[model samples]
Structures are given as C-alpha cells and as structure tokens.
Target: MELQKTSNGHHDLSPDRIPENGSPVTRFDALENITEGDTFLPNKSNGKIETQFTDFVGKTSFGMSIFNLSNAILGSGILGLAYAMANTGIILFVLLLTSMAILSAYSIHLLLKSAGVVGIRAYEQLGNRAFGRPGKILAASIITLNNIGAMSSYLFIVKIELPHIIQGLLPDNSDYWFVDGRYLIIIISVLVILPLALMKRLGYLGYTSGFSLSCMVFFLISVIYKKFVTECPEEHSYNKTVPTESIYNSTDGMCEAKLITINPQTAFTIPIIAFAFVCHPEVLPIYTELKNPSKKRMQKVANISILTMFVMYLVTAIFGYLTFYGNVKSELLEMYSKKDTLMLCVRLAVLIAVTLTVPVVLFPIRRAVLQLLFPDKPFHWVRHISIAVCLLFLVNLLVIFVPNIRDIFGFIGATSAPSLIFILPGIFYICIVPEEQEPLKSRPKIQAIAFVTLGFIFMIMSITFIIIEWVTGKKTSGGH
Candidate 1:
C-alpha cells in the first residue's frame, strides 16, 4: 500500500502503485492509471482512495430535522424562561424573544456558512482548521461547559419533580417512600440515560422527540387551563403594587423586588432567552445527514427549523408568563403546585419528557469530549464514564445546594449561556475562513457586527451579575 499526494494537496491512496516520496505529482488522473490485478492500487495505510465527497445517507426527514432542532432549543430552558420573562413585563418579554430569535438565526447561518468553506462537519474540527489548537480547545471547553450547565439545569428540574411523581404513586403513609431526593435523581438518571447512551446510533432517539413535543404541549395546555379554571383569591395574591424605593429597603425585599422589577438585570436576560433558542451550531451533523446535500436544501432545512422553533418558543413563553402572571416561579413544577390531579399529571408528563430528552441532547457533547480526550480508545468506557460523571455531579448538586429555579436560570444564563450562545458562534464565523462566499458574503459584515455587539452586551451583563452577587453576598435559591 502506498499513499501519494496529488498536486492539489489531497492524499491519494493506492495498493499496487509504488509512489516515491517528493515526486512531482501532477493530478489524481495520473494515479488512476495504476492497478493491482483488477483492483486500483491501495495506499500505505491499506485503504483505497475514495471520492472527495461522501454521499449523504441518513433516515432523517425534514420533519424529524425540525423536531430535532426544536427539541435542542426547547430543552430545560423553556422550564425557566417564563419566570425570566415575568421578571420583565409581557411587552418586554416579547421584544426580547424577537431579538433573541433574530440573533440565533444569524449565528446559525454563520456557522453553516463556515462549515461549507472548511469542508468539515464537526465544530471542534472546524475550530481547529480556522483558529488553531487554542481555538479548538476553546470551542470544546465552551461546548462542554454549556452542556454541563444544561445537564445541571435538567437535573434540578428532575430533582424537584421526580420525588412528587414517586410520592404520588406510593401510599399516603407508605414507609417505603424514604428515598432521598438526591438519591432518587441519581437512580432516575441511571434508569433513564444509561441505555440510551449505549445505543449505537442516534436515529432511534428520533421517535422520542414526538413524545417530548407532546409533553411540552401538554405542559403548556395544563398551565393555561389551570390559570383560567382555578382562580387565586385577592388575599392569596402575592402580587403587590409597591414604590421603587420600597423595593430596595431590605435584602429580602430586594430579592422579592428583583422578581418584579424591570431593570438592567431584566434587560440582560435577553441573551439567556437567545441561548435557549440558538440550536444552529448543532445542525451541521443534521445537514450532513440530509438526503440531498446542497446549499439550497440545507438552507431550507435551517429556515424551516428556525421558524418552527421561533413559533414554539413564542407560544411557550407567552402562555407560561401569562399563566403565572406577576408571581411566576422559575421552575414549572412550582407553578403547578396549586393545581389538582390533572395539572399534576401535566407536570409529571413534562418531567418524563425532559428526562428522556436529556440523553439525546447531552449525548453529542459527551461524544465530542470523549473523542477529543481519547481519540484512539474504544467508546464503551467513555460512554459509561461520561454518564457516571454526569450523574455524580447531579447528585452532589442536589445534596449540597438546593437551587430555586430562578437562581439556576440566572447561573446558567450568566456563566455558560453567553459563551455558547454568543461568543462561540461569532468566533467560529470570524476565524473559520479568510473570505466569505456568495450570498453569505453579502451578509457577513452585518452579521459580524450584530453578533459582536450582542456578545459584548451579554458578557457585560454576565460579569456585572457575578460582581454584584459577590459583593452583596446575597444569593437566590439556585446560586452556588
């Protein structure tokens, strides 16, 4: 087996051809002339030269593609976004959601354009080609951190909801119901995630998307119905009209005020909402799996996915916010606390949906990290290790810290959200290629400006929050 470099710098592999080193190679056509019996010559690595482009062969349809993209965006974030929006006003929430949708769309488009130029399918690979080792490391770190935060958020949701579901199934005074919430979280994660992680292919999980989508819809419907049907008494109302000065009178008062006040903290939350909806970078593998891998087809898939996600998000945010009104809590479980069996069932459905959805969303991140860290090793150990580590972290989180959903959202938004949603996409776009191609070139300048500006704003807000929290020593429910 011999490997020869073509004049164009691409490697050509052949079996029979005895290629000399440092030869003046003209074209791939010259190498085609060599044959071994009836077969083409193989390369030194005992592999035959294949075509430059691999054929796209995947079972995902446009609908599944949209479902996959939407599920990625709608994960754990939707659980908390309404409360974040309620902190701001309804009008402000709508405005922020719109801005986030646009930003997410632009960021995803830029990532796809970069993928086209580099002829790479993975984000880390593209980052390596575009920026260098440090850039690759940065990309991997950002993705890993973002995913850890996401998984933590999911774990928090599960911790709150799973115990209730278990208790509901048990007798009212059953002695067997002595399981700790944190222990239950670990058990639920193992029972739910390990098998899913061990699967050889991802396509099987596609069906679960239908279940997840249904759960999300049901959760929304339940909230809407509960709000309309079960009315809160005027005395029971946590809603109050207070002067701005009264808001800052005491530490506990400030915490309550922060929930209702529309200030810079509220303004800064736009990027968190944006982070929740930005699923574009993850679309590369989906695009590569398309039956027809053309620019137009890829664009169509992206456009449809983004549009579907936008509508779903808009509806979820509006309904969730309006349902809770001024007193909305971060987690949907807390919002459903006052409801009866029907609403409890809705919460249960959401918990199941999110639990199933977690492995699918987190699998890619685990795969990427394992590949980066242990490129040459078999994947079985990696898969097991990743799941164990994730579960252990969740257990520790639940044990040592009890986070209210709002604090969890704030931590996620401030730390991991900005890097994943803003910094990575902009850097990937700017650093990937020397110049932009075609219709993409027409928009790069504007896109670059918008991404940079948004990134700056997000980082500023995140940093400010961190500083304020540190100085004031005042922590919310989810703060570590």
Candidate 2:
C-alpha cells in the first residue's frame, strides 16, 4: 500500500487497511485492493474525477446551453438586425450571416483549444495566460464596456416602447411620456432583471430555457404570420419612390449613388450585420459543462448554435425587409407601427421577449467586473453592485440621451462590437496555448497561413470602419 503525506507533514495510514482510528486515506492506498464493491466507493481523500464528471453533466444540457447561447447572440442589437438587412438587401444579408457563422465557429474552436491546453475557464483567465495581465485587463474591460452599452441600449428601447404601448392603450393620455411613465418603466425593468441577477449561479436559471425559447419561437411565428397574412397599404410597395435629397442626408450628392453598390471588400464590414453574428466568447463557459468536453462535442454544439442563429436571423431579416421594402426603418417595430392587429401583436411580442432577456446579457458583465475588482470576495455582493451600477447608468442614459435606438446600435458596433467579437478571440487563440499543446501543430505551416490571413482581414476591416466613422463627423439620427 502507498503512503500519503498530509499538509502538516504527517504520514497517514493506507486505505487498503483502514486504521483503527478511521482517519482519511489517499486514493493510491485504496487502489491496492481490487474488490468488486470497492469500484463504487470514492477515494477517501479526494474525488476530483467523480465530482468533475458529475458537474460536467449537470452543468451541460440542451435547454440551459441553448438559453445561454441565445442570450449571448440576442441583445439590443437584434432590434436593428432587420433594418440592417433591409439596407444591404436580403441576399447580401443571408450571405453575411453564413460567413459570420462560419467565422464564429472557427473562433470558438480556437478558444476551446486554448482552454483545453491551459485549463482556463473564463475569457479573462485565458487572456491572462496567453497575453499577460494586460491582456486579461483589456479583454475583461472590452466585455464589460460592451455589456454596459448593450444594457443602456436595452433601457433606451424600453423607454421608447413602453411609453408608446401605454399611450396607445390610453390615447387621451399624451402625458404618458412625461408623468413618470419612463421612471415606472425603468423601475419595472430593474425589478424584472434584478431577480435573475441575484441568482447565485446560472444553474438556478437553467429552467428558464423553456420560457425564453418559447418567447423566441412565439415571436418568430407572430412575425411570420404578420408578414404573410396581413396586407400592407399600397404605399408600402417595393417600387415606391424615395426622395433624392433630405435634411437627414449627410452628403451633398444624390442619395441614390449606385443601383447595386457592392464593395466586395467592404460588404462584410456592415456594423449591425457583424453584431448579429459574433457571439463566440460568450460560449466559452459552456465548454466545461459538456459530458465529455471533447473537441468533437464542442464542434457539434458550436456548429448547431451558429446554424440555428443563422436560420432565425435570415428568416426574420428577409420577412421584415420584404414587408417594409424601401420604407424600412432601423427598428423592426417601426415597420409594423401602423399595420394591422396581427403585425402590431408581433412587434409587441418581440419587444417583450427582448426586454425579458436583457438580464442574461448583463450577468456576464457583472461576473467579469466582480472577478476583477474583488476576486476573493463572495460573488453575491459583486452581483448586487453590478445590478445597482447597471440600473443607475441605464436610468441616467434614458433621461439624458435616449437618442435613436438605431444610432445606439451603430455606436455600439463601432466601438465595442469588433473588439468583443473578433479581436479578442483571435489574439487569445494565437498567444495563449503552448506550442507543444497545440492540436493543429502537425499543420503548423498551413495553420499559420490561415490564421494570419483571417486575423489580418478582421483587424483591417474593424479598424477601418471605426476610423472612418470617427473622421466623417457624422451623427446617427435617433430612433429607427
């Protein structure tokens, strides 16, 4: 039997023959015996393998996994997804979705590789191991800032939709926008999100998958029914003529500069399009939940999630774009504002779904900030601070600069969108994993070529759009 040493430097009796005192013993000592019942007994000292395996299965499941995945993909940005697709044309939007999905899958694969080799769980941890403490700080900062922007945008949406919905119910009350309706709505939103935030672990909300998925499916069905069954006014025809010049136009030239403006190169740089498809980093936590956490299972989940998102976004974008045609606005609800009952119902459903789902997006940011500032403290207080801070910022933004939601989407896309979606994953993948542990080392030459090529492409496109927006002095008009 093997001997074991405790932290106090005491030699403990072997497990094969228990001491009369019944002290703890190590697994190596227990392994000396090969009895039938012994296989079922856990090692006296530690049960790392058993516990990890059980946790993996418990943590990973179709419902919760999908909810987390969808939570990451669906955010305030979805409000503008339909409009962005309409602007670019249906075919272009579909192509972009496809490409983005593939790229996102590739990025997740890289992340899984790094995580497996280094035993990293969080994105910040992976960043620290790969690029240094600075990398961790940068990665965490980007995610936090992006989430803040996303939450603020959500608040902006609630402020806009809630007041309008309430006023519609009470047409005589034009004062709904002023007489604490905004404040009430903000309070209601905070209350709804707070409970979800207060949960000590995401596992507690795992049951929410069915509700969230139902909301999503119902929302989609309503949109489809509204788009196909209801007949829009003749004015909504696709062939409708648009005014050549307007105050909204920033350029002096005619608005219709090109019939089919295909910037083969810049076509992929559309902000909202990129925003809709980039959600890889958010999927990192679920890797450990898988029963096996094998590379194959990871790839399957990644592929399935991406495909599902692509199909959902494609259908929604196409239908919304077709319904609005040239009159399309940035927010999908605008297209249904004056439409029949069915259309209005769909718009309201989608708004509710998005509002309810806001807290999931905010959770990650809260966790990241808590890890950074008070890593050693109980995470519950950190969650409280995060909720408070989020509510405060959201309320202030709603009061001060609740500009057009469309423009807010653009601003988020311009600033934090690219960094969160593309830059961070690519950098971490390349830098974090040791050379010996890299799974694709056999094809290092080809892998290097592809990595550099894709990395450079993403970097150049993201940087260029950000720079152009800064230089053009253009301000996005509020409310799509």
Q: How many angstroms is residue 50 displaced in model 1 relative to the true structure, after the best TM-score fit?
A: 11
lDDT of 1 by residue, 1-480 (tens): 344432112332321223444344432233323221112322234465432222224567666666666666667667666666655655666677678777777676667665655544456655665565566676666666556556666667777666676666553633454445676677766677667655554455666776787888888776666666644333443334422222322432322323334543454445456566755435665665555455456667777766766676667666666665546555545656533677668777877777776665565565457436643344366555665467445544643386554454465557556666667667766655444232335467557756867787787877676567656764322211
The numbered model that scores best in TM-score is 1
Per-model TM-score versus the true fold: 0.76, 0.74
Return the lDDT, model 1, position 206: 64
> How does candidate 2 fare on TM-score?
0.74
Clashing pairs in 2: 404-478, 404-479
Q: Every model's Cα RMSD, please?
A: 8.1, 9.4
For model 1, the run of ten residues with the poorest summed lDDT: 34-43
For candidate 1, the per-residue lDDT at 448 reads 73
Candidate 2, residue 4: how far the Cα is off, in Å: 23
